[model samples]
Target: MKAWFKSGAPWVWLNGGAVALCMIMVVGLLGLIAVRGFGHFWPADLVQMSVLDRDGDRQEVLGELVRKEVIPARVARTNGYTVAEDVPLVTRYLIKQGNRDLGSDFQWYLDVGMGEWHYPENAIVVERREWGNFYGFPVALKEHGEVISRLGDEDFWPEVEARVERSVDLHNEIRRKEKVEIGSINHKLERLRLERRRLELQGVSPEEMAQAEEQFAVEREALNEEYRRIKAERDAIYEQIERDSFDVETVNGMEKTIHLHNIVRVTRSNHLGVFGKLAHYMDRFWEFLTEEPREANTEGGIFPAIFGTVTMVIVMSIMVTPLGVLAAIYLREYARQGTVLKLIRISVYNLAGVPSIVYGVFGLGFFVYFLGGSIDELFFPASLPAPTFGTPGLFWASLTLALLTLPVVIVSTEEGLARIPSTIRQGSLALGATKSETLWKVVVPLATPGMMTGLILAIARAAGEVAPLMLVGVVKLAPSLPIDGNYPYIHLDQKIMHLGFHIYDVGFQSPNVEAARPLVYATALTLVLLIIILNLTAIKIRNTLREKYRSASD
Candidate 1:
């Protein structure tokens, strides 16, 4: 054993075991996230069970079994529940009885009191636009105050499905007209107003001002006409959606009228076969990826967040790559090897260790308040008080992140430059190549792959950053995406949604904790996947560069 230790076999085994353990942990965590996140989209069979309270009153519970908890008997007793002293542990169930409109939310029941469980084939889960989900059974469908169809009728299910699909299409149409087309008109009108204000502030001649006003009036009148037409079209679709309604009966026997317009999905969990459930899951997962957030971001899709995150990272990469590469080149290739260089490198390294929130503070103060405010005062005086570029926004957020990740890029690139064999440079110079030619053509190309390594790290860090982003531009909910139909298309001045902040908001700031839990997992998984995709793309490019420059490595 002593000889084995001296031979370093034990140390090698220890290191190998440590690495294996880490890999296992990482894979296990990713697997857990996948199951918890994707499983939320599946249409779980709703269960009906009898639950008894401390008052000895039994109630019929119906909804999806969301969670189960096992607690020590003393803990349960402390929560004001009466249990036998002999029982050391108490099990409880949390049912998502999500009839929020009916003054119902998720409810917990003691496991000791639960009697019989049932999964009714007729029970349906109604995903709604407002007030959360509705767990009940459809009894009848109504149209314009008339009973169009009754449940159990042969055509009822088919009719309901058809109408729901119609509602969805109509809803999308109305939203596009209102939020997209109409919104574009509104944006144009605002820009016109700002332009006129700028002219007034500029002290333009009366004739010139009058000419500008005439042009503005023509454009404004055209926009208004289009807006009116689109608004009318949207209202007509809205009316169609409101025309259909359904009567639902809850487990407690109370009847409620739910308008078809208010619902997003209707799923018959128990009756759905494997194929049906898979289709439903695909539909739900697609919606989660493509739709805008609703219900304080606890429900609906996070398309906006995804778009904003990708856009910001791209913008940050654009800003940082040149800056980081230039700095690294100067430091590594041109700078004198002196104490000053050593201190500069140390400062760059220390910058990476600074608390991320501190960068947020610096960004807010220097970038937003100082630089942005100056830009607004100099070029956008007419939009001054309103701030324009003076506010925290996408541009400032990206710039802030670029600053935060600058060190990673510099260090990685500098190392890459150092790895170039001195013999390569000597040969280039000996072959009558100029110093600049040797450095740029021979050294830089070889270092491209290493620079990409830095970029991957920078992109990964920038994408997940929330603290600095929140101070600079990220919002709990952005009213509009940074990119739109407006000229200059990508609005750097606009606020944006980020997946990291979305996770934090849904997990901690949401009003409904239970609802937020599943969403948190889903958003987290999305962020992880996004990072993986971005890193893979960078890695692919790096590998390609390495292949092209294989002689450098050799």
Candidate 2:
């Protein structure tokens, strides 16, 4: 053992252990994320279970339960209310309020054929066939069951259409009332004008004209008063109707009524059977990465966040790569090691260690408020006071990340440059090559592997970064895509979605945190996979560069 230790086996063991630990950690993280994430995408059936409450009379009050397919209802007793033990019951929907044990009151049965489940307090049944949502409507089919059209499985379009038709009728009625009032006012005014004309033709005495004028004035006053009254009434009716159209209370009431017919029946899909499943899985994947802003879950899409992350990362890479390479080149070829250079190097290193949040603050103040605000004033004078770039946006977020990861690329490129031999430069120059040509053709190519290494590292780090992006461009929900149909097309000032931000939003910020946990994991896995794909591509390029430069280095 002493000999082995002397031979450096102890150090080898220590290094090996560290390497194994790191590998384990990475694999474990990936496995956890994948299991959670992919599990969310797995095909699920809509399982109907029975929720029961034990009344004070010891009789059970049964409640309708809806859940994903095949979820076990393992019961446990709780404060007063009985819930399905193993069943993942959505308490918000089933039980309005109560702390009750889940095990004692409710039982679960898996029902495969029937869309509804009714439990006789003693037995609960659950079952499954393929189920999914289509055009914002939940749908299902029983195993080997014929397609049947069930009532109330249509989109909010039906309700919206009904509301719109009613609205049109109401609007016409209002317009009719407005026309009647306008006609009445016009008729009275015309009558008064006719009377005035008659008096004018009669050449009445001065007192008579005065009294006629006074009579006309009183009639005019009454007409104005009547018109105002009619206008007020019309406005009140219109406002009330408009308010009711978007009324939360009315909408909720309608939703509940519609939900009563929210039946999931076995229907033949327009898509082939497996295709439906695939589509369903993709929808779940999208949901894992994003949340719908509306109850219908149709108004929002994933393109915004997808575009934001891609655009920002690409923009950041563009800004950072050349600057990093240039700085590294200058340091390696021009600057001599001295106090000033050392101090500069130390400063660069220290900047990398600065907390990312501090960068966000700096970006908010300098990039957003100062620089962006200045540009807005100079170029967009018409938009005075309200600066476009001064808002939190993709441009600022990308710029912040560019600054944050500048050190990584710089350090890597410098190390790559340092690795190239002085002999190669001398040989190139001796061969009558210009300094720029030699540096570009020989040195840079030799250092390609290292440059890619830096790029890969930078990409990985940037992809995982959330804090700076949060303050700069990320939003919980973006109303518009980063790239859209608007003028100038790419709206850098618009807020964007990010996968990392989505994970945080679903995991910690969601009202239903526990239910969203699996979704969070899936989103995280998707991000991890993207980073891995990027790293793999970089590695492939690095290997190619290394092979190409093998002879040059030797």
Candidate 3:
């Protein structure tokens, strides 16, 4: 043992064990998140049971069994629950009885209060737009407020499915017309309005101002006509969609009529086979990735958040790479090795260690309030009260993140530059190459891989950062994406959605804790995947560059 300690074998083993433990922890954490998040989409069997209520009356309860936990009888009693002295442990169940519009969607029941429970084949799970979900039994299907088919009829389900499919199609068409076509027209009208205002502010000649106003009026009139046409079409679709309704009887014996237009999907969870459930899971997972969120972001897809995160990271990378490379070159190649240089290096290193929230504060004060306000004053004076760029937005967010990650790039590039031997420079100079040419063509090329490594690190940090983003560009819900079919295409002045902020909002800020819990896990997993993809892309580029430069150096 003493010989092993002297030979440093013990230290090596300790280090290996530490690394293995870290890997195991990371994998375990990811596995847990994946299981919890992905399992949310799977169709679980619905249960129907009779339970004794607080008043000792038996009530019918219908819902999906979400979770079960065992609690000490003492703890249960402390929480005002009745527990037998002989019962040392009590089992409790969390039931998802989603009908938020009517009442609480989730409820807990003690095992002692529950009677026989069984899966009901006729029980249906209705996914809706406003409320979380509806659990009931189908009574009848109606069209134009008249009963068209009764639930006992063999053709009832087929007719309901057909009408529901039609409703979904009409809803999608209405959304496209309203959000895409009419939205684009409105965007153009707004731009024209801004342009006319800009012309007035610029003190253009009266003739030019009149021409601009005339053009704006023509465009505005055309857009309004288009909007009216689309509205009429949407109204027609809505009329068709609202013609169909279904009556469902709840567990408490209350019958309610739900319009087909309001329903997103209906599942017979208890009746589904393995393959059917798998298909349902895949469909739901796809929707979660592609659709816009609803119900306080507790339901629906995170496509906008994904797009914003990628765009911001790309923009930040573009801004940081050049600036960091140039600064590193000036510091390492041209600047005198003096006290000022040493101080600058120290400052850069210290900046990296500062709390990220401090960077957010600096970004808000300097970028949004100071620099952005100045730009608004100078360039966008016409959009005055609105304060165009004088608010937190994508551009300012990207720039802020660029500043936050700049030190890493500079340090990495400088180290790479320092690694190139003095003889390489001497040889280049001997071959009659100018200092600038040698630095750019030879030194920078060799340093590209290191610069990319720094970028990978920067992207990983920036992509997962929520604190700075929340203060800069991220919003709980953005009305529209930053990029669209507008003339400029990409709107840098718009706030964006981010997965990190989405996770934060769903996990902490949402009102429905049970509904938001799985979403938190899903969004967190997605953010991790996104960071991995970005880092992998950067690593690929670095590897290619490193290989190219290695051959050159040889």
Candidate 2, which segments miss by more than 4 Å at Cα? 10-14, 45-78, 81-283, 286-303, 485-487, 545-554
Q: Name the better of 1 and 2 by TM-score.
A: 1
RMSD of each: 1.6, 15.8, 1.6
Worst 10 residues of 2 by lDDT: 123-132
Which scores better on lDDT, 2 or 3? 3
Model 3: runs farther than 4 Å from truth?
Answer: 74-82, 205-208, 552-554
Top candidate on lDDT is 1
Worst 10 residues of 3 by lDDT: 50-59
How would you encode candidate 2's per-residue C-alpha lDDT over 1-554 as one tens digit per residue?
88988999889999999999999999998887887658655444322233333442222223223233433233223344444455564323331111011222223322211233332221111111111122112222211233222224464334443444455456556666665665557657866876776677668888998999999999999999998887887787676445322111110112111211121221222222587668756754665345333222222234445556677777788888888888888887778989989888888889889998888888888998999898887765444466678788988988898889889998999899988889989999999999999999999989988888888888888888898888888888875567744346677787788878866776787654434556666667777877788788879988988997887667
lDDT of each: 0.92, 0.61, 0.90
Q: Indicate the residue-level lDDT of 516 in model 3.
A: 92
Q: Rank the candidates by lDDT, best first.
A: 1, 3, 2
TM-score for every candidate vs. truth? 0.97, 0.63, 0.96
Output the lDDT of residue 394, model 2: 84
Model 1 bad stretches (over 4 Å): 74-82, 551-554
